[model samples]
Target: MKEVIATHSLDEVGKHPDFGSAQATLRWMLIYMVEETAGHVGDLDTRREVLDSEKG
Candidate 1:
């Protein structure tokens, strides 16, 4: 999916529906995914550190 997105042209992006264009939709989705994933990772890391500290 990433490779397919990288190769998509401006014209192809413009053809996307539901968000004015494919690029706009793709850009927002990527931003949202990254932020959400980062938050989850941070939360998991914090929990792991706390658990390890308690065990030590």
Candidate 2:
């Protein structure tokens, strides 16, 4: 299900729907990409913080 959603989202990201202005389409794509990247960055920050806090 996750893969299916990702695939469908990528397909839409490429098309740039006709109803929206070019800048609006680009903005939407940029927001999605930033959000996806932020999720990964948050995960990495969490792991690093945990490692630093551990008594090793």
The backbone clash count of each candidate, in order, is 0, 0
Which parts of model 2 have CA positions greater than 4 angstroms off? 1-24, 54-56
Task: Report the CA-based lDDT of candidate 1 relative to the real structure.
Answer: 0.67
Tens digits of per-residue lDDT for model 2 on 1-56? 45645556443534446755544344476677789999999888889889898532
Candidate 1 lowest-lDDT run of ten: 9-18
Best by TM-score: 1
Please give the RMSD of candidate 2 to the true structure.
6.8
TM-score of candidate 1 on Cα atoms, chains taken together: 0.58
lDDT by residue (1-56, candidate 1, tens digit) is: 77856877433433445656335455666667889999999888889889887531
Error of 2 at 23 (Å): 14
The local distance difference test score of each candidate is 0.67, 0.64
Per the 3 Å backbone cut-off, how many clashing residue pairs does candidate 2 have?
Answer: 0
lDDT of 1 at 11: 39
